[model samples]
Structure formats: C-alpha cells, structure tokens
Target: MSEVERPARGVSDLGELLATMRPELDPDAWVFATAAEPLAGAEVTVVEAEGVTSVLRKHDLPTAGDAPARMRVSPPFARITLQVHSDLEAVGLTAAVATALAAEGIPANVVAGFFHDHIFVPWPRASDALASVRALQRDAARAGDARG
Candidate 1:
C-alpha cells in the first residue's frame, strides 16, 4: 500500500503537550537601543531609525532612554524559538503560540524574525510553556498523519 500524505497538525491538547516539551532559558529580558542604530543586544532585532520622540509620540513607546535609535521590542518571557520553514509572518506564529499558551494559563509575547519565530513567556512558567508548545507540534504531526 502506498503511504498517504498527511495534512499538518495544529495545536490541540495543551496539557499533554506541556508535559512533553522541554523548557528553555531566555537570557535577556528587555533590550533597548536608538531608533537609528542597528538592532543588537537581544534575540529580537529592531530596524528603522525613528527618533525617541517619534516612538513615544506615534508608537506609544516608553521613553526610558534619552537617545533616539532603532528600537527592537522583546519583553522577556521564558522564550522558545521554533524554526518554521513555512512562510508565516511573526504575528501569525505568535498568535498560534499564544493560543496554545493561553489554554495552559501561560501568558506569552512573540517576536518574529526572518529565520525563526520567538516566543516569550513568564520566566517562572518557562518550562511549562515550552512543553505546551512542543505538545502543539506533536499534535500537529499527529493530525497530519491522520489526514494522510
């Protein structure tokens, strides 16, 4: 018999998923730089040189620093980055991850880049959070198999 192709699985059982996924540690919590400067410091990269005034006035960015430089935003959550080969934007991936985390009572913030998707969750719940995400992946795989 020829093996059937399967449709990819999406997140389903959150509890079981969290139990299986290994938690990872995130180094930096908050990264800040000038709007004009290159994105550096943390995993999340910020580009475009908008002045601090512009960020504050237009984007409602917190004015903690005095200088104007390119800003990259990543609120530290116990974060895990998945290398998704699919052409999904950061916001879409974030929404998917957030949906899974929410089911487990884990709050998450997502930062997207060109290569991978980054998820930030509360430091305390990092392990549980990672497990939750991994579970989602497994569930997706299972669903894909079922379709095939």
Candidate 2:
C-alpha cells in the first residue's frame, strides 16, 4: 500500500494565502446551542464550565415538541469555509478577514481548524459576507500579480 504524502506545512505567506483562498459557504442554517450533553451530529463542539456548546445545522435539531427544555440556541448563522489550507502559524489572515467583514458591519465568529479557517456570520448577511471575502482574495491576487 502506498502512503499519501502531505505538504510539510500549509501556506503561511499572507499574500499567497489571501490570493488563493476560496471561500465556500454552506447553504444550510447552523446555530450555536448549549446543552447538558454534546449533540450527536454537531459539526463543532466545545465543553465549557457552563455546558456543552455545539454548532450544528438547524435541521438536525429536534422539533420544539420533542425538544429539551434546557436547550439554549442562538440565531441561525451561515458557515463559510476558506478552502485555502492555511498554516497554523499564519498571521494576519484572521485579522484581514475580520476587518473586511467588520467594515460591512457583519459579526464574524472565526474557528480555525488544523488546515482551514471557518467563519460564521448572520444567515441574512451570508451573501454579503461571501462577497466581502471574495473581494479580499481578488484584491490580494491583483496585488500579487502587480508585484510579479
């Protein structure tokens, strides 16, 4: 059997990272909920002193009639995953993304995984957020081109 080779490290150059980042938005509505136990199908989960917080699709949630009385859920959000495999040590990427979104008055909740960064924004502003992110990438790419 052959072993698959992985890149020694993800892209760390800010310019390259931004120039190549491809943001893909998930169409489903996701929400942050706090429950006593972790949700079975949660995409992200964190255990805190208060309770377990999970980010999962709204459709995965149980109907109100069958819901737990103690579950606390937040407003629906849209998940935008940056397709670029960014290095863990990469700097400025989060700041740049946050700045771009903040300029348009969108609140971003960023989560960094081993290889990529995910941004969650209000569901209503998903399109706007996507445009802003794409613009950031476009501008960076143009700058890189000019430099070359």
Candidate 3:
C-alpha cells in the first residue's frame, strides 16, 4: 500500500488557533528594511531585498562603514510570532490578530510566513500586546470566533 502524503494542517478556528500558538517578542530592537544588505557584525537579519535589510542588532550605534541607508529606529518594536502552521489561503488570521491588537490600541504590522504569522508592535507595548493576544485566544476558544 502506497503511503499517502499527509497534508499540512491549517487552522481556521480563530479562537482555538490563537489559544495554542505561543507568540513571543524579540528583546532586541530591530530595524525595518533600512540596513545595508550583507551587513557584517549583526545579531539578527530578517529580510534582505532591494539592496536593503531589516536587521535586529544590539542597541549600539553602527560603525560609519556599516551604517544603514535610511533608518527610523524610533519607538523600537518587538517581533511576535504565532507558533502555528498557518495556511496562506486561510482567511482572517491576519485580520483577526490585527483587530484584537487594535482593540487594545496596539498597532500591528503583520507579516505572514509559510508556517506562521508575525506581528511587530512597539517595544514597550509588547507585553501589553502579548496579553491582549492571549486574551483574544481565550475569548476565541471560549466564544468560537465572534467575528462571524
């Protein structure tokens, strides 16, 4: 008997999904599409496109030789990842997360990856955002998606 390929699981339940996904925030401040590509002496790099990169590094000034082209490193942000295998075709995860954060007056800049969705919000408000997201999960698990 030929073994059939197991399909990737995609969650459509807003409440159940969020309830289990352990979202986390990065401690270091990260830059958004500003650093020069192929940067040396960096801690983390998110993306490299169009000769620029969004990098996460220690809170230290860059050397003149490695300075970013244009940086707006203010109101430092934190990265939160939904630890779940999310389907790209799946609808409403992004909207739901954003909406929940918005309800707490926390702005969310979402980036959807193959296996997960990421939200970047103000650094100081990261805890607040995390709490809000967790609460959303609880509400969803209890209410089964009130967004209908």
Candidate 4:
C-alpha cells in the first residue's frame, strides 16, 4: 500500500501491539552521555534542564583530546528496536516490556520514536533482554488467539 493509504496512526490496540512487536537487536554498542550539545553522530538526543542527553554508538564518541571536557558517559548498551509501528498514544507497551526485562534483572531504557520504540539494555544482557521480549510477544499472541 502507498503511504497515503496507510493508517495515519499506527497500531493502537495494546494486545495487537504486544503480540506483533518484533524486537530486533542492533549490532553496534551504544552509550548514553550528557554533553553541552549533541555530538556529531548521536542516534537520539533529548534536551533537558540539566543538559543534552545523547544516545550514540560507542565508536562515535570523540577521543579524550577532542571530546567535551566534562561529558559523563554511561555504561555500554545494546539497542533493540521494536518493528511494530506503534501509535504515539498507545499505552502499556513500554510498561509491559520493561516489566518483563526487570523480572530478568535487566534495566530497560526505552525511547519512543515516531515509527518505533527503541530499548537499550546493558551490553552484556542484550541477548537475554531480547529473549525476554520475544517471550512476552509470544505470550501476548497466545492470549490474543484465546480472545479470538
């Protein structure tokens, strides 16, 4: 279908969103940092009262000599982007995913974009986090089937 024919708002049904969200883990290592301004290759940036928070690949950061004098960098992370096109107003998606990861003793950093929801978890726990999310999707699908 053409873009014009597509639904203006992506999937809004919570069950459908959960059941169909195909989480894909990215291959690159990422980091969260606070800088005076977003660096050259940030994938996402949020401006807050404290400063600009940038999410970028680890390799994208500048060397110490070229970097900002006072940037604070977080631990390495791995990103997993949900393939499902979720509506901005959709509820429960983030909570459900986060809860699942939390149960596995993993911390989830979720970022909602216009097209997808991106999740960042500790680099060492990326695979486990992905598996947890996929299991949640499977359970949701089974529940949806039962409802049908």
lDDT of each: 0.52, 0.95, 0.71, 0.95
Clash statistics: count for each candidate: 14, 0, 0, 0
Cα lDDT over the full model 4: 0.95
- lDDT per residue, candidate 1, 1-148, as tens digits? 9998754543334332333334344553433334554332223334544532111111234455743444444333455766453333212445667898999999776655444456767767778887888778777667666666
Query: Would you give me the overall lDDT of model 3?
Result: 0.71
Candidate 2, which segments miss by more than 4 Å at Cα?
A: 1-7
Error of 2 at 47 (Å): 1.3
In candidate 4, stretches whose alpha carbon ends up further than 4 angstroms from where it belongs are 1-7
Error of 1 at 26 (Å): 4.8
lDDT tens readout by residue for model 2, 1-148: 9998865799999999999999999989999999898886798999999999999999998778876669999999999999999999999999999999999999999989889999999999999999999999999999999999
Q: Tell me the deviation in Å of residue 133 in model 3.
A: 0.3
Over 4 Å off, model 1: 1-40, 45-76, 88-92
Candidate scoring better on lDDT of 1 and 4: 4
Clashing pairs for model 4 are: none
**Model 3 per-residue lDDT tens digits across residues 1-148:** 9998867877766556766677776777654535446455544455645444444543654666666666544457788888877777777788888998999899888877667887888877899998888777777666664554
TM-score of each: 0.53, 0.91, 0.70, 0.93
Candidate 3 RMSD to the correct structure? 5.1
Sequence-dependent TM-score of model 4? 0.93
Clashing pairs in 2: none
